[model samples]
Target: MTTSSSSPTVDHAPRDPADGRWTPRLVLILIALAWPTQLLAAGGILGANAIAGVAQAFHTTQVVWFGLTLTLVSTLLTPFVIKLGDLYGKRRVMLAMTALGALGELLAALAGSFWLVLAGRAIAGFYGPFGALSFAAVRDVFPARLVKQASGVMGSSVGLVAIVSPFLAGWLIDTWGYRGVLWFLAAATAVAFALIALLVPETPRHAFGSRLDWPGGLVLGGGLTAVVYALGQGQS
Candidate 1:
């Protein structure tokens, strides 16, 4: 994950923030290198795999509906991820997103119910912050000067992959089946979580991070779950 220090030009040696220098070009490149992998872990592959089970559980007719439902719920949860970052720390938020995404993918792989699947999908969606946070992580890791360039590079890498993620995810599902795809995604997410643990460091910004807002998280998560479930169910 990232901290407020969103650039790649980080001082390996402890230096004052004022002394820390980052290059926009270098930070952008790191983000670019990391983008496709993040997309595969967070969106492109896992998302497409999720559709098969949702289709099987809810019917093909409701696949679109399920997607819509999940999207809305994700919208609800996404801000909380950011806000929690504001309150706590960005790295903590990102770790939650990664870990939760991994858990959700595994659960969905074994899901038995429409409700259960919805929950799993929601958990998976919680990890969606890779969309925004990689930049934040770059910001966290690098100096302020280079953060933008790094963002561009990382953004470019993933942007190119965006065109193909769906097709690739689709092929995996078609070739192997839903469970297989989920299992693979689960493994991928787990790896991602491990990488975050190993490669990424917690931000000093959140060293004295804000308290977790359990009530807010629950209330928001619950409301979103209800809305997504209803939409997936396609009520009149």
Candidate 2:
């Protein structure tokens, strides 16, 4: 008997099939993540719709800077934002980004100077990573089998917002001007923050003990900024 001893086997199968199935909680998480993603995607159209008003308010013809600043800042910030989420926590970074985005929107809404408005747009660019982070968060939280479906849901939000945001932005700009558009963004971001706080759970998987490659990030950001700037200048 002593010579025939063996280690006991362990069962690796899922305890319950329902554990990974679609549920109300997962649905809520999807909604919470999708809300901010749609808002982030809507920024470009909103800015375009309100450009004339913004240029007149600022008394400048260089209305391109409004969109340009946002695009550049977002391009620069997205990599860092994604890394931070991986190192620390997705939910934590998302809440901070949403809050900052709302603050940026408010600043733009209340700003009286052209420079201040640009600054606000730069800050709001933090929202750029919302879609990427939301997708990652969905992957982290949803069961493997359901990831594709969840991703589809998240991807659809952008298209849906695109269809509606132009009409909404036109209405807001017509009724209340560019500042009103900023105010609407601030309000929407606030709602997103609340929903995320209430419904979205923190992801368990994190690249803990891993460090962000700051030097690489800086190099990449600089290169991207240069390329984007050149493209914009070429277009102009």
Winner by lDDT: 2
How does residue 179 of candidate 1 score in lDDT?
Answer: 68
The global C-alpha lDDT for each of the candidates, from Candidate 1 onward, is 0.61, 0.82
Give lDDT tens digits, candidate 2, residues 118-218. 89988987876787788888777777888899899888768888999899998999899999889998899999999999988777436666789998888
Q: What is the C-alpha RMSD of each candidate to the true structure, in Å?
A: 6.9, 5.7
Can you give the lDDT of residue 176 in candidate 2?
97
Cα TM-score per model: 0.67, 0.89
Worst 10 residues of 2 by lDDT: 7-16
lDDT score of residue 96 within candidate 1: 76
1-236, model 1: which lDDT tens digit per residue? 86675432222312225434554444333634373245544464456555766677566555654345446656667656665655555556666777887898788778776667667766776776566565666766666766676667665666666666667677767777766666776677777676666555554443233566668877876687677667666765
lDDT of 1: 0.61
